[model samples]
Target chain A: MAAFIIANGAAAMGDDVTMFFTFWGLNALRKPENIKVKKSFLQGMFGKMMPRGADKLGISKMNFGGMGAAMMKTVMKQQNVTTLPELIQTAKEQDIKMIACTMSMDVMGIREEELIDGLEFAGVATYLGEADEANVNLFI
Target chain B: MAAFIIANGAAAMGDDVTMFFTFWGLNALRKPENIKVKKSFLQGMFGKMMPRGADKLGISKMNFGGMGAAMMKTVMKQQNVTTLPELIQTAKEQDIKMIACTMSMDVMGIREEELIDGLEFAGVATYLGEADEANVNLFI
Candidate 1:
């Protein structure tokens, strides 16, 4: 959530923002609806265990069986802070580059069609190249 | 562990490295010996619950009640990979700059006297200033 907020904030300020999702972070990019993609046994189990999308994500701290996430969302709504989905939408609207690490996707058996639209799938080398040119490259 | 390894690697290559420790990352910078400091009840509890130093830290993944961390350390030893403590020592030896986030320390109730020596304390503004001048700034 911090990553998205920062990315959106940077984009809002006319800064070119790029978000690279890898490993568990890729779960945030999964479509809310289940996508029928063939996978190995372990990957299938992994997929079933992991949350599908941003809304399904749990807060890192004090997530008492997801109650904390619900409370956080409620508080955020009350505070008029942009919700995670809204932040994601804003990111798309602002043309923030969202890249999913291809190596992680392959390792986790996540197919391209399983993720949302407007994402570029690439490897770490691409991220490194981008980082080289970027003034601030953050790994959240 | 990744942070320390990367810092050590970068410093070894003669690139000036600065590691800004925040939140749980501060635990790695703590002195192993118990330090008696006056604190609120909550602060004392927080300090007691958290790991004191790098050696007491657990692996993020597959750490089944610290067994996984022990297994990983053994494997790292077998593979000749630098241990976390060794990586931290190498970072110090190579003159890598390490800063502990003061805001995080206050929030987590960690004291300067409880932390290892050779660390600078600063806030986010200092991080931003350093990052602005950095060619590649990574959050991790």
Candidate 2:
């Protein structure tokens, strides 16, 4: 579903969008970088790990806050808006190509040498090159 | 910042983009129709009443989420990406013309007849007219 929104949005602008997922979103591509665990002291003490990977990081369409996102979801459910997870899954199923950022890996002690397979690395040039062709671009 | 991004992005595609915010993002607009309380059970049950308009509903880029928001934020911050709030504020400060989404406003029981001053309202046709001429039309 995340892919679907991204791919569709990028496609809507008719531009080539290259998502450079550093940290966790890179999980989808198995890029060498893993997101730093911003552990709460409590969670850290308990050794409770957060969800990992791009697969887990790509959020849904509804925003979270205030009523803690329930309002958006309630309205969406009432209005029949698609769920974020569904959109991410749909994007993947639709074959949206994603790229992982390499710089973040090096910054976070993630080893491109040890990154998961099925992923490739490209630097700012790669992102800029693609952005040059993109009519629209978004970080999230 | 939003205007800079939008102008640059739209111009990148040689398109004129109209950024219309409804719900929470509209808070910057100062329209009468956009004064709502984003109350929860406690707030709703105990706080004073507020408008359920666009300003309160629009979200800031720094802390937005749908599904896998946590990882996305970490990656974005690490990547040095700017948040949407900054983008919107930049747009406002830079004099970028922003339109509020009237459909969303009305659905939220907003009084379009009483929207904050300086805002223009038309249907999707308004956006469509601009979008039609635009080589790239964007939702963000």
Candidate 3:
């Protein structure tokens, strides 16, 4: 969410933004529905254990099971702050480059079909290349 | 540890590196000895609860109390990998700029005397300025 907030803010200011998702961050780009795919037992377990999408992700701190996330959503609605899902939509509309790390995807058993549309699949080398070109690069 | 590894690697390659520590990351730069300092009730509680130094931090995953970190250290030793403290020392020798966030220091009630020697204190704007001047900027 912090990464998206930064990306959205930068994009709003007319700066080109790219978000590289790796490891657990791949959860943010996952489709909500479970997509059937063949995988090793360990990978399958990992897939099942991880959250399905942005809406399902738990906060980094003070997340008492799912209740904390629910309370946060309620407060966000009250304060008129954009929800995570809405922020993701705005990011898409802004044409922010969202890249999913292929190595992480393979390790986590996440397939292309299991993720949302409009994401480039690549590895760390591609990320390094982008980082070298960009004025600012952040790993969140 | 990942951040330190990257910093050490970059510094080893003769790249200018600056490490900006904020929030819990400040713990790594702390002195192992308890430093007497005045603080508000909440701040005192926060200071006491957090780990003291690099040696005190638990691993991000499967840290069954402190056992996981101990196990990791054992493995690193067996593999002839440099320890976290050694990595930090190398970073200092390489002259990697280490900056602790002053705002976070205030929030966590961490006095300047509580931290190790050789550190610059600054806030987010300083970090942004440094980031803007660099070819690669990462928030880890």
Candidate 4:
């Protein structure tokens, strides 16, 4: 959510932005029904237990059985603030470059088709190239 | 470590930076000997389990009983990369403003004296006030 918000804000300010999604971060871009992975028995359990999509993601702290996430969503709606999905949509609309880590995808058993449309697939070297030229590089 | 590295990098590039230390983040600023907290049984247990200082912090992923953290630290040293403590010290030297959330401090039972010197105390409103005027705002 923080990454999406910051990317949206930066893009809104006319700055070029690229979001490099790696490892668990790629889960945000996964299609709800396509969010399953089974690298190992433990990892499969983690995948099943964790939230599926961006909207379903819970807060890192004080997430009481997803109640905190629900409450936060409600508050965001009330405050007219964009939710994670909406922010992601805005990011796409704003033409912010989205790249999924190919190596991470391979390790996590995530296929390109399972992710949302209009994303580039790249590796860490690609990310390093971008970050090398970026004035503000963030790893969220 | 990502936060500190980015902050240090930004500061090196001459960008004005302010790090808002809130919730679990305040742990990085804690003096190793003064990291104890007894607010509640649960909170105290958390304090006991968590790393005491910046140098002791474990990796977010694959942190096998702090083995990952120690290994990473060793690799960082070999690569001549700045360690977390060194990064924090660099942040101080670079004059990056470090703000501790007063409300978080109260909740976590962290006192001002327990934190490193040269820090400001503020709440969310204060963070917002600075973020409002800044061209780039990150919540890490």
Query: What are the clash counts of all predictions, listed in order?
Result: 0, 30, 0, 0
Task: Put down candidate 4 lDDT per residue, B1-140, tens digits, no spaces.
Answer: 65776677677777788999998899899888854434677666666676677877777764668655665565445446667889899999999999999999887767787788899999999999987776566665
**Candidate 1: pairs in clash:** none
Task: Give each prediction's DockQ, rounded to 2 decimals.
Answer: 0.19, 0.09, 0.20, 0.07
Give the CA lDDT, 0 to 100, for residue B58 in model 1: 90
**TM-scores across all candidates?**
0.60, 0.47, 0.60, 0.56
Model 1 lDDT tens row, B24-77: 789999999999998765566667767889899998779898899999999999
Pitting candidate 1 against candidate 3, the one with the higher DockQ is 3
Better of 1 and 3 by lDDT: 3
Worst 10 residues of 4 chain A by lDDT: A37-46
Return the lDDT, model 2, position A4.
41
DockQ of candidate 2 is: 0.09
lDDT of 3: 0.85
lDDT of 4 by residue, A11-119 (tens): 9999999998976788888778854443554334345544567876778777897799889889999999999889989999999999998755654456787788899
Where is model 1 chain B poorest over a 10-residue stretch in terms of lDDT? B40-49
Comparing candidate 2 with candidate 4, which one achieves the higher TM-score? 4
What's the best-to-worst order under DockQ?
A: 3, 1, 2, 4
Candidate 2 lDDT at A42 equals 57
Inter-residue clash pairs, candidate 4: none
Q: Give model 2's share of reference contacts.
A: 0.00
